[model samples]
Target: MKWPLSKKMETSLLACAIHKGEKLTNYCTDHNHLCCSKCVELNHRRCLQVTPLPLAATGKSTDFKNLSVSTENALSQLKYYETYQKDRMKSLKVSYKEHESLIVDGLRLEIMSFLLQCETSTVNRTHEHMQYTVIDMREKIKYLLADFEKSTIKEKKEELNLKQAPLKVVTNSCIRLHYELFHLHVAIPKVLDKPELSFIASTKCLENIQQSDIFIKENFSNKVFTVNGKSVHNVKMPSDSFTCDILAVCALPNGQVLVADRFNVKVKLLNQLYRVVSHLDVKQKQLGMCLITPSEVAVAGHDEVQFITVSHSQLAKGRKLKLQYRCCGIAHHQGDLYICSPTALYKFTLSGKLVCRLFEDTSADYTVWKCAVSPTGDRLYISSWYKHKLLTLARDGTLLATYTDPALLSPHGLHVTPAGQVLVCGWLSSTVLQVGWEGQSKLATLATMEDGVRWPRSVCYSSTTSSIIVGQWEDDTILVFRVE
Candidate 1:
């Protein structure tokens, strides 16, 4: 009795049915089948030529390899889309909560105005209306975001999994979608539940959406900077005898600027025209300054951080945060304060509680002279005046990169723009250079000595007028460059 062939062995043999005892060695491409050479010769002599089985198998293997690569790319894209959606959801919640707070604060201001007018009945009605309106608006947004998560976002995710080409087609769609959502979030507060304003907001949102779409099509190129004009404004006060030493500059949301006058021991506010409109005497010499709110600023003094508020073009002293370390430079991100001593950088809460020592450089007395946080709050930059270096750090105090340039020497001030460009000024070089977001390379020389940037001590960017403000050492005037 013949030993039964194993199923695997029989499959490997792959004998042709029509050709008895003949192994299949050729593939008929036209008919798409495997057959013995004898069978091909007998049945397909006039037909298209047959290929060897190995050659046909090689071609099929190549096709499968191409398919595998495509699958991997599609999977990678889907993973990215998943992460983007999750982040967008988190941002949505944060933005809505912030807008809600703004609405409450705005209503309170309105109530105060009503009280001043002595309209008791109107105040009561307005207060009650505001409470009801805020509740209604919050509920609307809550439901809207819930519906969006349950419907639009979820449906898109499912579609991405089901179809691969569509994922590629809409890979950049999130940018436009984010712009639309952000525009709506901004417009909601301006609307105040008014129908006419809502219509206007919708129109403006459409325009922004269109612009975002155009931007996406262009592959989000870097913005080109051109100097549109330049001007100088003297920040020296009539009461001060010493020349101004503006060590740091902070730009507010309402087109106003605040400069830390180290020599005069004052924090001076500049209006839209770059003229000093108001000043607050901080007893000790001030160093770095940062915007705490749209109407408030925190100036770092010798050993304390002084908080000042701006109202109706006037400056008023507020609370002060006393630090254990000398406060030479200060920056704010989210709810945390980054205060820099000459040799160390510390993170503190608004109430003066120390969070942690973020960084320290004891090599020199002024190794960490000034600090600034990026808009996203992920990266922190510190200017080392003595070392002539810019150190970038992660939020957790991990050193990311150290940047040095010939155009930048004795870097005294660090300012991260809303667009995430890092602007650093060299005190000794009298130059202002824009560094990349990672603080790894210098992107451009924004201003030089020829551009009237003399002994630049601090740099700030005002988005409202598209201008760069440079504060100088021992100079009564600050240089402002309007750029596009």
Candidate 2:
């Protein structure tokens, strides 16, 4: 079926070089043909140099394909070599497919944000403690105003410091509880609110201690994300007024970045680049939001789909590759690309070809409005806006369980943290909820006011910085919350 260039073509050309009126040499480096020194000294010499060729008759030159085969085999082994390689990168998928439900990326950011808030809260508690110390000193003055004894008043400051440790321990206990709640968030019965009393009252200090309690009750609250001054920029709006999102971003080793701006519909190639780069109004309106993978760029819209290349002079003019649905979010797993939409999710082969619709759950009445896959890529958490509930789905699309709480009136957003914790936002309640897997425990409120919360339109987590950025529709302001 296959043949190498015949040795006759090679040898005949060599013999012609020698016999057809040319001198011979031991090597012909420049001409790449056998030639003599006489040929070099002649016009041929001034024209080219002579170099030696490998022994053709001895199968040296003939083994070129074998050499190529050897290199190909070496490369294949390299693909699996531990020191030389890692697991093949999957498609920059829109979904994780079966890997949808391990650890959630967004939730990890929240937990990290919560952790940061913890440190700030602790500092706030210490400040309150110092203020109380001053109050205690004043109380001793008031008590001795009538008794007027130096030794009696002197016991107050020493005793207050000695008693401070237990109060610190109680506050630490609540902090621990908060951390635990962030992990296992389910709406359980409220805790007893067994707040610790930092100051104790004896007959001598009764009135003063009561005042301390009143002061603490009035001022005690978690002090975190008390923003002094923060700013944000690089806001972009799509031509069709579609909501844009920063779907995915990765910083290169050189500090360059590739960002997938989904709604504005562009994969922006960037360096340390400008701080704010808005998307230009794309001219080719044939189909779909444009999303670029590391290798290929695909133009997609609500009703049309086409895969193309960036280097091509005109992507709209390039060969169009057809796809089944309007693609949305994409994710990368073990060498396959997964894409998601409001109604469905899909997997694709490496060749820009459709593999299959991996997740398609169209109930009789409602459709999935939003979904997020866990890190290990084994499960998916799907949310239905119409039904006001959530479903934990197996990789194969089986409904494993439904999660909801009476307190969850309007669940607008959902995320799973790396530690297997679920975070949800309630629009009507204006609160963020951390719920447990089995729906038995919960942090009834996170970062919401006692009166009520305004509807939070969208939320994202910055894992590198460990912060949660939420967009509040009603407040017309963005809130950055840190995790403890």
Candidate 3:
């Protein structure tokens, strides 16, 4: 059947998009698509109510004016939406700038506040030092004057005859005192104004304070501990096949303990009596664990750190932080995470942001094995497993001291008690030693091979139960030392 086609219609309408050089002649009512003969044969062969364009439009009541008005209204609405989106983009830019400025200002204020605190502390210490110096000087002067007054003329002449050695000694002492006082007076103002100098001075002062504290604790505090009792608890689960190699132990405030089972790739939670209550299986082997909060803990895996929560004695896995470097040991201090690679130690935020690399020793692979922070968060203790040494670092990564003892062989685990006593276990020697707070010397030998501490891998002190929990390698049982 031949249909009359107008040339004007052919010139005005577009060709079929799918079939090149073919006009859209038929309409498919079912699919609501304009189709050419080839499109109908290939794509819409079963579409119902297919009609030619002229037949479809022949008897329809047309409304050209209303359709044109509706088209104009739709275009206007689209343009208005475009304009509104552009305006929203501008507003977002403005808000971003404002937030940036606020963040920068807040950082500046924080720095200023820290500086002010440092200045005030430095000034107060300087004043106290000056006062002590003046008092000492006056006391020495008074003693010298009294000695002269009490001496007879014959004694004075005899002393003068003896080359006046005592007088010369007194004179030199006074000169030295005067010089020290003068140096302090000249150095205080410069240190207060300079940030770097102030920080260094503050660190030195903190060290001195720590040393003094250690001295007092050793001499006056009488902190003596006798092993009240020892109990061994097995943490092997029934679903485990291999001998449990417990690598790390963490104690919470509520007397619960979390132990990382390296052989089974699980973190087990223990009740107050040190019995396994619940456990969470992880994908990777966990090497270390530390308490992030009273009810939260972080487990250090091979390539990431996983956070877990404990509620009502049940264990639940939380978020995971993926990292580029391997995480062997983990410690938390003041919302900052101290992660240990085999040869380096890094500081990171809780949200997976890297802060800085605090320390690194690439001489050996297991040189930087495990870490622990002091209760005050000013000192960091790292165990060098291969070297049989312990490294003490400041908050800013300064190596304060390195401690080595004959009893401490292949130190693996480190923990600081609430009273600031450091406890470290020797993996090779099968011994646990109590190190001083300053990390200068070993205070006491806590346990030995005879005490059944074999290859102790981790150690933690629980203030809630007043016990020392020790995790061992190739041992199914953990040792708990009750101390008074």
Off by over 4 Å in 2: 1-275, 278-322, 328-332, 350-352, 358-360, 364-366, 406-421, 426-431, 437-457, 471-478
Q: Which of the two candidates, 1 or 3, achieves a greater lDDT against the reference? A: 3
Best-to-worst order by lDDT is 3, 1, 2
**TM-score: model 1 vs. ground truth:** 0.58
Taken over the whole model, the C-alpha lDDT of each candidate is 0.73, 0.42, 0.74
Pairs that collide in candidate 1 are none
Candidate 2, poorest ten consecutive residues by summed lDDT: 195-204
Would you list the clashing residue pairs of candidate 3?
A: none
Q: List model 1 lDDT by residue over 444-472, tens digit each.
A: 88899998888998899886566898999
**lDDT for each residue of candidate 2 in 1-484, tens digit (9 for 90 to 100):** 1233344422322332335654233344454444445655553655544443322122222232343333333322222221111111111111132223223334445545654565456546787775565456546545644353333334543554454544455444434333322211111111112111101001102222233233222222111223232233233433424444443333222223333444455544433332423332343332222224433444444433445443322223344435566544443444455555556766665455777776666763334544555433445665555566766776566677777666665555565443234556655656666654433346445556443345654444433233444444424234445554
The candidates, ranked best first by TM-score, are: 1, 3, 2
RMSD of 1: 20.1
Q: Which ten contiguous residues of candidate 3 have the minimum total lDDT?
A: 198-207
- Report the number of clashing residue pairs per model: 0, 53, 0
The alpha-carbon RMSD values of the candidates against the true structure, listed in the order shown, are 20.1, 31.1, 33.5
Q: Higher-TM-score candidate among 1 and 3?
A: 1
Question: Which lDDT tens digits does candidate 3 get at residues 153-176?
Answer: 345445444544433443344343
Task: Supply candidate 1's per-residue lDDT for 17.
Answer: 49
TM-score of each: 0.58, 0.38, 0.57
